[model samples]
Target: MEETISIKDIFKTLKKRWKLIMLLTLIAALISGSISYFLLTPVYQSSTQILVNQKQSKNQLDSTQIQSNIDMINTYSVIIKSPAILEKVIDVLELSQSVDQLSQKITITSQENSQVFSLMVQDSNPLRAVEIANAVSGTFQKEIKDIMNVDNVSILAKAELKENPTPVKPNPLMNIAIAVVIGLMAGIGLAFLLEYMDNTIKDEKDIETILDLPLLGAIQKISKVHNKG
Candidate 1:
């Protein structure tokens, strides 16, 4: 005959192993918190915005020119991260990192059909991140004028140092929360696995199920009687 488990059985199993589950959950949370706070290095990010427009004397912009500027944003994004621009930035800032290394720290993004693009830099030092972001934008603006002969690239916003900048990575609370969930799942799975592996009979019901026989009766345990003095 096929056997089916009830909700009571699940609750019983959980109740029996709740201590182990709680232990594992606490251990996981501690480990995650430790890693987030002590092991992982904090990374700070700063961003600079650049505006792309045609240097024209006209008071109004033509739709064609606007679309052309929008299309050029992609090319500009690539050029901003290129060695041609990044090399100049490194030279100006005298950064210890190479062009490739600096490029890895930089990110270029723009809104769809927008003329403004943002350059973000991430570093361990918030001030360094801000400096790198601003330097990249300034260098790109100067280099683009020489390379593409386009004087339209202008620094819309420069990165500035903040009094208390926040790190972008190693979020301890979120990490601990995720770890707790994983620990709970793992602990519950292990509990069920241990229960499944155990073969010894615990009660009359287990004996009846294993032997395929009806339980007639159960014996009561006897305790030692104390002699009166």
Candidate 2:
């Protein structure tokens, strides 16, 4: 005979080990919160936008020129992160980081079929992120004029400092929530595992299930009488 467990049995198991589950959950939450708040370093991001427009006379403006500008925007995005631009930024800012390190912190992205692109920078300091973003945009604009011989690049927007800028990573609330869920799942799994591994006959139900027979009766233990003999 095969035996099947019901939802009630699962509920009973969980209730029996509720204390252990709660304890694990609390422990996980504490560890996650600590790592999020103290161990992980927060990174701040700042971004600036630049507009790429061809310097053409009113009579020279046409669809071909606009399409060409849009196509060139892709190349411009690549050039903005190149060492040619980053080296100048480093020298101007007097930053100790190398070109490769600064390049990793810089990001250039443009919208599909758009003439404007944005440069974003990330750093541990919010002010430094803003400075890097603005400096990269300015340096790229000046260099693009010399490299491409096009004086059409213009600064659309400069990065501004915020009074209370928010860090982009190390979200404590989200981390804690995830940890709690994982901890609860682990605890539930362990409880079921231990229950499955246990093979003790504690009651009439166990006997009936194992022997595949109806429970006849149960005998109660009584104290043995002792006489001074």
Task: Enumerate clash totals for all models, in the order shown.
Answer: 0, 0
**Clash count, candidate 2:** 0
- What lDDT does candidate 2 reach at residue 162? 98
lDDT of 2 by residue, 21-99 (tens): 8988999999999999999999999999899888787767678878888899888988998999999999999999999
Model 1 regions more than 4 Å off:
1-4
The candidate that wins on TM-score is 1
The sequence of per-residue lDDT tens digits that candidate 1 reaches over residues 1-43 is 1234666777788999999999999999999999999999999
Off by over 4 Å in 2: 1-5, 59-61, 221-229
Query: TM per model?
Result: 0.96, 0.89
State the C-alpha lDDT per candidate. Answer: 0.90, 0.91
lDDT of 1: 0.90
The residue pairs in collision within model 1 are none
